[model samples]
Target: MLRSLHLRAISPEAKKVGLAAFLSATAFAAVLGITAPAQAPVERSVAAPAAASPDSVELQLLGVNDLHGRLESPKAVRRETGGAPVDIGGVAALDAHLDRAERSHPGRTIRVHAGDMVGASPLLSSRFHDEPTVRAMNLMDFDVGTLGNHEFDEGGRELTRLLRGGQRSDGGQFKRDAAGRKANTSAPDFEGVDFPYIAANTVDREGRLGLPPTRVIERAGVKVGFIGVTTTATPNHVLDEYTERFEWLDISDTVNRQASELRRRGVEAIVVLAHSGAYDVNGDPGAAAGEIIDEAREMTGAVDVVIAGHTHSRLNTRVANSDGLGDKLVVEANSYGAAFDRVRLTLDLRSGDVTAKSADTPTTWNDEVAPDPAVAALVARYRAALGGMGERTVGRLAEGLERAGSLSEVAARAQRRLANADVAFVEGGNSRGSLAEGMVTYDELFEASSYEHQVMRMEMTGAGVRRVLEQQWEAEPDAPLHVAGPDEAALDDDATYVVAANALLMDQDQFTAFREYGRGVRPVGTDLEALEGWISSRGRETGVGG
Candidate 1:
């Protein structure tokens, strides 16, 4: 059953009217068994009974962030007792972990995502436009989610379609059933998302949110309100044309305003699901905190909990609210379903307020736990749809290609040649994985460059090249840009040269010098296809498998 909550503006003032109207139409939808009012009133009854007890009730919140459509577990990095890397994460294993957590918490548990549940997905899910991920979430019973920058990768229309459910623009269909069996006919229509996606800061040209701003969940006589928001820097990450109609408001102001409205409606226990996070350093989650901390500080004492993402860091610690609201719970689970934030809130039964809270981020290892059969079936269905593309031999490697060595140089050279430019630059991070020895498949190639980045050829002066290289030090310190063709020996300060790079690097604000100094910007092929052709050609030349 579809369930949702709509929170209208608390005041009718001119300034707040727009936010109120927007929120009233866009609030959390109950994907679980919980029910919420379609529209909440400004004032709510808060009278306590004479028999109100001093005892507290505990609520468990299990959350994941930056899932990024990892329907199956990726290669493991941590070793098991048997000296093998532990195979951890994937919807099935995650479902098992959730089951264990739910069984421990019983009726007091709720599941949530902090954003980036989709986008930059592997071919298994992205090939089908991330419908499988949504389906998996539905089976897992996610209560609520927020938008991430990646969710807007394909623009508002596609995102809207994913949330609303229907046939794809291309009228594609699932090729297999949930049990992994090939279907005799086309699969059913996409059912969209079962849960509501909330984003308080993202508003349309009409000042309306794309989804609900807040969602209230009541269970066992306790009510908790959640306000969801994406980072203000969303536009900087996504394509401009996709987000042209939307504006991001100040996160702190939006949360504070929404908290006020929720409080007036008798919601004293509040949580903020922000798609922004701080890095954990020296065992402190707030160490070198980012925008989420700023928003939490500005929230004063109105907000009690903050679940964050985007940085993909695993942290669980408390940050004191500026308004003397005690310590606010701030937590973030690592990305790609690797870990989850398990938070427990102790609520005062009499005051209807959260008295204390604590949280932990645990790895979702599949070593000991059996995969959830249903989720496994779902993943298999999508995996089957990948057909032979995943296994088709692309080339063979005599040895693994390291992200920072000759392999990267080779890739850059290939990109440069594909764009017919003097040099090409590829970020170290963009090389998601390395090419293993022996046969290399299309899947491995994709794993190396996971993003749907297109190649762009542009002209830049030698000075601009040096500036872009220098900018790398801003983050990676000694990290060098893998350049092909023009070595340091061939450097010319004022000479103009043609270069190629992934669209993200070319368009990023950090590399604005590329555009400011660049001329004759033209699109080449996608990074994947170019790399494929390059690898194929290399295989023929080297007499390797192709």
Candidate 2:
């Protein structure tokens, strides 16, 4: 049996006058997936439908975001309402959940995502440029999606190809892995997404919108409008060259204009899928606070509901619009497909506006439900394609390396060697797992250096290098690494020396010192490759990381 752990639900009603402000709250019957007095969402199982009145049509949005290409189970767990441990989040489980929604609602259900469907993903998915994740979304029949900062990790050229289909970035077909076995050989053939990806605020070098600002689709005799906007802070999240050709516009202003245009086209029921999210300060959904709240509050009544992403926090409360009425329903499903928001919208036929709306966030519980076989098979094929790369021996550790303090030090040593620099400065939290003693596999090493950050070399004076170390304290004053390099005793202020760091750290705002005096900066290779090289050369023939 499959079950979804119900986390939160809130029903919102807006005033008929503005037809947009959340006027009051009412109790809504939300399907909690388990113990709901209805059928659980198992494979081939259908949920009970939301009843519709004569003058109204009921629709459902299976809102998902930040999947991050989790085709295989991430093996993560979350506490249920009463602090009981519950398994959650796998592509197959998510697929099964979507199937249940469609089986119940049929044509009335719309599968939608709010961006970050790919990028920064697991090895199985990221290995193939996230094609598997896109294929899964296509199989799940996602109707629409938007862009998150991760989408721009490689810049617009690659992003356009991912969205529209083209030759692989390496310009080679995924015919076989290194082991000479068939790989990613599924239907749809890595062509592109079956649905549309919208982004209103992202503009290209040619001074045109990157994607359609709004998409209107007819459902149950009512036309629902969707507006997609990327966060304005996206540039800071990605590399400079990739996003230099594009510009991020004002989020709230762009949404208001797009919503007004949608209204002109008779789309009174509008949903803004903003790639921006709120931060939940407390357990209460209403108590959440973030920039998205400010943006929603500034929005006009033309917008009814806002779906947020990016921060990956759970939000299911309504915030006040510019009219000083709590009329807007803002919701965000937790990231990595661990959970999703079931948005039930009721629209008035005559007014063409949403009369009532509510949301239920159900965590994907693998133990309670069977994995969708279709997606399960797809995952199997990809895992087979992953070959033995994951299990291949990378090196042997000298001892169990500690997290945080020790991990960065080891990675820093690798960076120094890979870039052939005098010192290597790496950020903490790069790897969530610690290296244990003895034989280390590529998977273990990859997990320790999973961000895929490129190693970069910078030419700087010894004085400038000291400034970089000082900058570390600015952020972590309590206990800073301080980083004593081999050349510390004989350091000269005016003499230039080569320094290395993760590329993101070199270019990010926090390390302005790194970008200021660093000259002849260039990427060496990926952080994982550096770690692998360093690890393999250190201990036995296999290596010395601790």
Candidate 3:
């Protein structure tokens, strides 16, 4: 039988140790295709139904979070019944899952996305400004969603255009044909989002919500209110310019206020679709904790369920609301469209209140489910538009390189070579993934350095460089800045040196030292092109793996 692990929040040290153990245990279960003998089922309390009768309604909530424009299936691991590593998470696979659920529940099901639907996407979708993803979501019939930090990557203006389609900010039109070629038309048609995007806590300069604060869906005489909220720390994650016009209100305050409004409107069964989540170490959702937990506890009597994302952690557990409205279900599906939260809510139709709810996260394994034909066709079109560039082999790696190690080194080398600077620096987070062994494709390389950052050359004193390196530790104690072309033994504190970095590192206020110390900043090439050129130029000489 499939068994669940009990997850609970532990100290950072304990987390690191526990994470290893958890991975090992899950991997063993996956490899054997059986539950570990020592593993125990997660315990959860189910509330008694509120006077069951013909008036009661059952609502099935199917939702995904942090898809990040994964139109294609990425690599994933499954442990439910000891499955081998599987290719998981494509729009088509997600569609299949949704299809099965909807067919089972029929009209009683509502498909919702938590957030991070776009931004930091693969080239296939990002190249088209994530229009393909929006189109895909529409095809999937997503009911509603909120925003995540990545949604603000390009700023509110672009976000507005995404929701209410029109010409891009630059007034350029780009409409692709079936073959993925841009049509020879002056104006490209862009379809706006069919479903509403709720942002209860995200307000404009005038302190008014830019989108609907909440949405009420009534079905079978039952009313359910969904309050959408993004993380309050959105500004810290996104470029300052993108968020200058907006304000992120307190999550708890916003949810409570919106819940009150929803209640006053004679709607109960309140759910908060928050783009923030707690970390679940085990299967116990309550055991996982984060900023969302405090926010959920604060909602107490107002909120019944919380569907969370952002942390990209799996959580299918419950937490008691401090205000004493019974236990509230909180859940998060792992990111990249790898999985989705399946929640069933039993509601009292007369009171329009949720009597009980249960949730679980199931992996969207591509091999197990046939692709949805329509979504598959849509993805194929976009893939063709990419023109096989992503698949072009750049070079070969003798061995796989971890994101922090070889990937970082390769990026630093590329910047140094492109800018001819004495020192090159790359933030750890900037390198998104690892480099696998064997033939590396442009797409694979792009995955490692996905951002469209422009190579920037700046002159900084050695002291400034050290300060910048030190800053990495200030924010993330464990993640140190990756540097190339700098020799500590030969370094001079007062000496001035040319440095190469991405524009994000140069302009962001958080890297004040880099900004203040940088001189003669100029863009050379995009990070993607530079990495590609660098790898291609290497041409298997010296081998990247070595």
Candidate 4:
């Protein structure tokens, strides 16, 4: 679709400006066209960027976020043309696209990530505890990356190992053994990092040093400063154990400090890679907190660009600083490698300021571009390496659930099968991706229940169930919490109920105090034996059990 549109829009001569630019502009326009109809009643038109000043360093920033270790192409997210059945993900393909841009304009490209690079990882990265993902980023030479909330999934200690990169967390060293070397001798140590991962908002309450705040990359004789920030609401998605040792600071303050330091260091152009999100100007159903844009505008000093992620919402707008400092360009590439983000920041070398720029988010259609051979090779290597691991099935799929059905339906069915509740309460995260046709494997099952949610069952009356559901719907958009419900329906409290949930969800803020089942407690399985027995009494069914 993108290629055809490109062919129709410009001639081959225009390709010299770089495919990233052409594809980005075209994809942005196409997405706007597609979403406009859905957003009717409220019409939105893309505003043209202001005129570029004569002097400025032309910086092309390409970014991706929430990759979640999707090294190969993802399965079709939706059946429609909204997502592709063909593979559009893979580091090789991404590398290929990057190469194309570089070939047109070599050494002028700055590739970045907005975080969530590791956890909920696919087989390739997960088998090695996200080491492969980190290694791939190193190979791709990421200039600097911000920390996403998922980075803490394995706890801060594991993340520190990856960041330092001295040795692989999988127990392998970067060095090789010599035939005559002593078995007890250690391998030569690897230099800590070839790149930097920054988390300005992340602080070590114990150690007192936070993740690197910013990096200065000299490209085309211009030094670009980048500030990084993790989400402030990270605890909502991560385990308490990992975050217990650290303190999360205000994002705006982090930005202010980093930007000031960068300017003090004589870096001219600045970009903020915030693991935050954008929202509609108004707080409607579609509008989320545009944290990246807001923070950039609010931060004092010379900041030119903001690349955002985490909410997975696509954005294309230039919000002027709320304090009347200046305009900050904010661009977000949609999640899952579904799109490519390109920000063209032109800087004036003489004045060390941005004079003119344009940034865009372009769809990455598998059908439109061939996968980069190198990236493909890397993905293929991982696929083959983990082939047996990925193929191993953990459970049978007898339930015939279609992705088209409501998310509630799938969650309810899972709850019914797992807990034998007359009415099951399902949380929103219960469903993130769709199950494809044919047998559902362990991979599919894990994807459905990826968060470390344990099997939690609590007995409750039908009326109690309805009340719990009411609490689920009342979750405020800003103060988003987990699903709410009593963990153990107390017989003494006048209701006997059985609820099954993951440990991760059980400890969530939303459900923690639901009807007074305090933190980290679950109903004893022995107590729910009767309910399990009743479920067993009925013949076992398969497939989502619906």
lDDT of 3 by residue, 1-546 (tens): 000111313212123235676455334434433322243233223233334478787888889999988888878676557867778888877876776665545567778888999988887877788888887787677778998988888877778878887657553345344354774322156676778899988888854336888898866668789999999978766767778889889999988888888888998889889999889766555588788988887884768888999998998878887856588899999898898988889988778888878888878776656665445655766675566767878887777778867777888888888898898987777777788877888778867777777889889888888777767667633446678876766778899999998877665555777786888888888777677777777747766622
Off by over 4 Å in 2: 1-50, 78-87, 169-189, 207-210, 395-406, 428-440, 470-492, 534-546
- lDDT by residue for model 4 (113-207), tens: 89987787754566555666665565565777878998887677667776775544434322112222322211133233347787777888777
Residue-level error in angstroms, candidate 3, position 205: 2.0
Model 4 scores a C-alpha lDDT of: 0.59
User: On residues 1-546, what C-alpha lDDT tens digit does candidate 1 reach at each position?
Assistant: 011111212212112225554243223112221122344223222222123245878888889899988898976866547676877799878876776666556677778889999988877777677888987887677888889888988777778878888766633343343334643332346778878788888887844335878999886678999999899988867767778888889998999899998999998899899899888777665464767776777775868888899988977777777756487888999898888888888788777799777788878877645565446656765665665657878876666677556566667877887998888897665665577767778777776766767888989889888778777666523445677766756779799888898877776666667777778888887777677777777754563222
RMSD of 1: 11.2
Question: Which 10 successive residues of model 2 have the least lDDT summed?
Answer: 23-32
Candidate number with greatest TM-score: 3
Better of 2 and 4 by TM-score: 2
Order the candidate numbers by lDDT, best to worst.
Answer: 3, 1, 2, 4
Error of 1 at 377 (Å): 1.2
Measured over all alpha carbons after superposition, the RMSD of each candidate to the real structure, in angstroms, is 11.2, 10.4, 11.6, 11.3
In model 2, pairs of residues that clash are 1-368, 2-368, 2-369, 21-327, 22-326, 22-327, 538-543, 538-544, 539-543, 539-544
Count of clashes, each model: 3, 10, 3, 33
Residue ranges of candidate 1 with Cα displaced over 4 Å: 1-54, 77-82, 170-188, 206-209, 283-288, 402-410, 460-480, 488-496, 539-546
